[model samples]
Target: MRGCRYQACRHEPLVVVYEDNVVDRNKKRWRRNNEELPVHLRRPEVVRPSRPLSVDQWNQFAWESSQASLVPCENCGRTFAPDRLEVHQRSCKTPLPGAPRKLALQQVN
Candidate 1:
């Protein structure tokens, strides 16, 4: 079969290992989970608990939270508590190229 250097997986007629590794890992995880569950409850279909974030809901909730402590980072654009911002503004050595600098820099510039 033809092979490419940059391509990680080759569809060769010989041994192909990357696909095998994925299948083997999935099989091992399934076996482990199957062993953990009781014999009577060993059905093909089982529901698992997962946590999913809703961006709109989270954003709305965050905006509604107390306005006193949160300030959007002039460097990173992340919202951090005022105390954290205080330390970050003083010590955050990573420069912000395009964004406006914090209040203290305006006087110097």
Candidate 2:
């Protein structure tokens, strides 16, 4: 029988017997009672889906892709040299309201 994936689950097989039925020993592990439980109930750390981008947003990305290295970040709209572009892309702290945080998240491990 396959054990439960959860570290907390101490679940064991439930043995059921019928009066007129012959035991089907060939059958494997029984299904868990909580198999149909909601995902939130099963896993606590669920990430929500991000909002969908509009057609204009896609067009902007496409336009940016066609541009040369002389182009700057769409968020900051500051032109930078090709060599400096990657570094600037990672560290630029533009004051734009909707712009994503410039700094990447530090990995704990």
lDDT of each: 0.54, 0.42
Report the error of model 1 at residue 20, Å.
0.3
Query: RMSD in angstroms, candidate 2?
Result: 21.1
Model 2 accuracy (lDDT, Cα): 0.42
In model 2, the runs with Cα more than 4 Å from the true position are 1-69, 98-109
List the candidates' TM-scores in order.
0.27, 0.23
Residue-pair clashes per prediction, in order, are: 0, 0
lDDT of 2 at 54: 82
lDDT (tens digit, per residue) of candidate 2 on 34-106: 2344332221222222666688976666555434224345446665544455678788665667655333221
Question: Between which residue pairs do clashes occur in model 1?
Answer: none
True-vs-predicted CA distance for residue 9, candidate 1, Å: 11
Structure candidate 2, residue pairs in collision: none
**Residue 89 C-alpha lDDT in model 2:** 72
